[model samples]
Target chain A: MKFTIQVNEGPYQHQATDSAYLFTKAALEKGHEIFRVFFYHDGVNNGTRLTTPPQDDRNIVKRWSELSAEHDLDLVICVAAAQRRGIVDDGEAERNGKDATNIAPGFRISGLGQLVEGAIQSDRLVVFGD
Target chain B: MSEIKKFMYVNRRAPYGTIYAWESLEVVLIGAAFEQDVSMAFIDDGVYQLTKGQDTTGLEMKNFSPTYSALGDYEVTKIYIEKESLEERGLTLEDLQHLTWEDEDEDWAEKDSIKLVSRAEMAQVFADQDVFFNF
Candidate 1:
């Protein structure tokens, strides 16, 4: 089965990303395919490339990056949410004349339509929230 | 159900803390206008949305749970609750007006139509749907 996972809350507030990770791992372990993982609302924070958590704690951003690289999962960050939260791609950073973009590797900034598309295309759609 | 689009609206916030619940309801209403089949699953603090007779006049927050009652008019009738959440909050079916709570004496695993379910089942609800929106 193919699955689409949506994360709505931001990092640190709830275990949104962590839950996403666990679900993704479980799906893969069960021999299920991950269609996409779309981050929206405060979840856009998960795509921030500059996040640096303490060494003692699990680094959710890095873990997501690793997962994407291993499974070739589509990690989509809502563009509007990203920009508003100061997470921009290089193109967006240049377009807006910002010196930097905070979008992390293994994640791409897109639109809500991608989420809509993911929902329409996937066999199953799961949400991780509080 | 004629190949209808299935939407799962996940409510995660408290009833009056923010506009999450109202905004989610508006989306559901819009989906219903388009003749979509909508289901709502409340988790965490969102369960408070089903608690009855809330007075928000002084808090200046809209009593949004009433809008949930209007869902039937919009053709949205399916509502689900997380079992562990209810247990965690010590809230019983008597605390919620619209909740379809099963009798404690029943032998059924999940007897209530407006039933309580496990976390994995909650996640499965999202997976089973075509469009799952969280608020």
Candidate 2:
């Protein structure tokens, strides 16, 4: 079965964004196809390339990048949400004339329509949040 | 046979805590606009949405609980709540102003479409949905 998971909260706040990392890993471990991972609201922060967690803690950004790289999953950050939170990729930053972009590779900035499209295309859209 | 596409919108925060509640409502509206059957589940702080008599007063935000009623107009009438959350917060059915009690329906109480259920059941519902989103 194909699954499209939406992560909309946590990590930045008191909740856990690790849900995004764990769910994606579990889906792949189970041999299920990950249709996409749509990050909306504060959840878009998960795609930022500039996140630096404590050395003892889990590196969520790196985990997401590795999962996307190895499994070839579509890791999408809602562009509107990302822009609102200042999480721009190099292309978006350049278009907006910013000095630098913070979004990581393997993750693309997309519109909320991509989230809607994920719903339309995937068999299951499991949401992970607080 | 093709499986019916089921969409579940997870409202995780309070109605006024942030823009999450409003954005979540929009996403659900979009899902219904696509002719998909959509359901909503309130968890953690999200239960505040169903609480009665919210006075935003000086918060300078919109009171969107009424929009919950409008969801039915969009063909999204199934709203679920977690039982443990209700008890943990000391909220009962009466604490919610908009919800109709299951027992109130003489014939449908046993099968009332909208009401509260246990967390385990909520987990099952999550597993059942084709499109599950959090706000």
Candidate 3:
């Protein structure tokens, strides 16, 4: 089965990000294809590269980045939501006249159409949020 | 060619208090372009999103309640409002806006788009969907 995971809450603010990560890892381990992981709303916060956590805690963003790298995942952040919350990639930062870009590695910013595309292409679309 | 999937957007929050309601609507508007078998379920506080006479003048935010009426034009005609959610909030189908859509199969006859369902029936609807989006 193919799955598209949607994370709708920011890291640390809600358990959604962690649950989505674990679910994605478990699905991949079970030999299922992950079509995409589309972040929307506060979920875009998970794509920022500047978040630094202490050594003792699990870095949720880093975990996603690593998982994405390991599985060649299509991790996307909604451009509209990311702009509203200031999570931008280099291209977006330059386009919007911002000084810096904070989009973490392995994630790209795209339109809401990706979410619809994921729904159309994947067998399951799981959403995790408050 | 890819098969047409049954997509269901589950709205569980009230409008205005959070961005979920508006963003969910945004997804619906975009998803409509896909031309899939799409449906929306109003559960919990989501029922408030369709209440009539919504005014945002004092709130200083865009009053998007009227857009729900435009959903029919996008071929999104199947809107399922959970009966219990309405009753829990002291609301009825009468309190919601009179949403309608033209039924092309019925010679362009305008028909009510809202379908009130029980909790059990809503659960069945969920089971029948190919994809479920909740916000």
Candidate 4:
């Protein structure tokens, strides 16, 4: 089964990203093909490299970044949403004349068309949103 | 690829006080360029999105309700509003904006785009869709 996961909320503020991450991980473990994971709205916060949790807490952003690295996943943050939420990439920082880029590893900024394309290409498009 | 798939945008939030409605419309507009069989389903608080005569002067937010009118121009002709949702919100079809589309096949005749459907019917509509994006 091919799947496209859409996370529509922030990492810790909402449970959407955690659920999406766990679902994607479980699906991958089950030998399912994850075509793409498109993050939208506040979900773009998950791709920020500056996320820091306490020493005892789970690192949500790092976990997603590592998961994508292990699975070779296509982790996409909607460019429009990311720009609004301050999730900047190197290219975006350069183009927008910003000083820094905070996008985590294994994630790229893109358009909403990627969400639509993921839906069309995958067998199922699961949305984990609040 | 010439393949066409059924796509549905499920709206269940009130228009203002949040960014969901606006962002969801952005996705719909972008998704329209895909030339898929697209449909917009308004249920629960989402029914308020189509209500006519919405004013946002003091709110300072850009009123995007009018953009729903232009959807027809983008070939998004299927606008489904759940019947029970309207009733629960104390709104009738008359309270909603009239949406219509021009059918070029019929010599450019104007046609109604709004389809008031029952909850059961809306579920059937959902079941028929290849993909659903909920907001």
Among these predictions, the greatest TM-score belongs to 4
Write one digit per residue (lDDT tens) for candidate 1, span A1-130. 9888988788777887788889998899899988899887678888876888888988888888888988888999877667767888888888889998788789998766666666666787788875
Candidate 1, RMSD to the unseen true structure: 8.9
lDDT of 3 at B31: 84
Q: Second chain TM-score per prediction?
A: 0.81, 0.82, 0.97, 0.98
lDDT by residue for model 3 (B1-135), tens? 267988899999999989999999999998888889999999999999999999989999999999999999999999999999999999999999989999999999999999999999999989998888888
lDDT of 2 at A72: 91
lDDT of each: 0.77, 0.78, 0.93, 0.94
Q: Score the docking of each candidate (DockQ).
A: 0.13, 0.23, 0.73, 0.76
Candidate order by decreasing DockQ: 4, 3, 2, 1
- TM values, all candidates: 0.59, 0.67, 0.95, 0.98
- Give the higher-DockQ candidate: 1 or 2: 2
Please report how far candidate 3 places residue A28 from its true position, in Å: 1.8
Return the lDDT, model 2, position B112. 36
Q: Candidate 1, after superposition: displacement of residue B14 in Å?
A: 6.3
lDDT of 1 by residue, B7-91 (tens): 7878877877665676566556655655656788989988888888888899986677777666656656678888878878999
Best lDDT among the predictions, by candidate number: 4
**How many residue pairs clash per model?**
1, 2, 0, 0
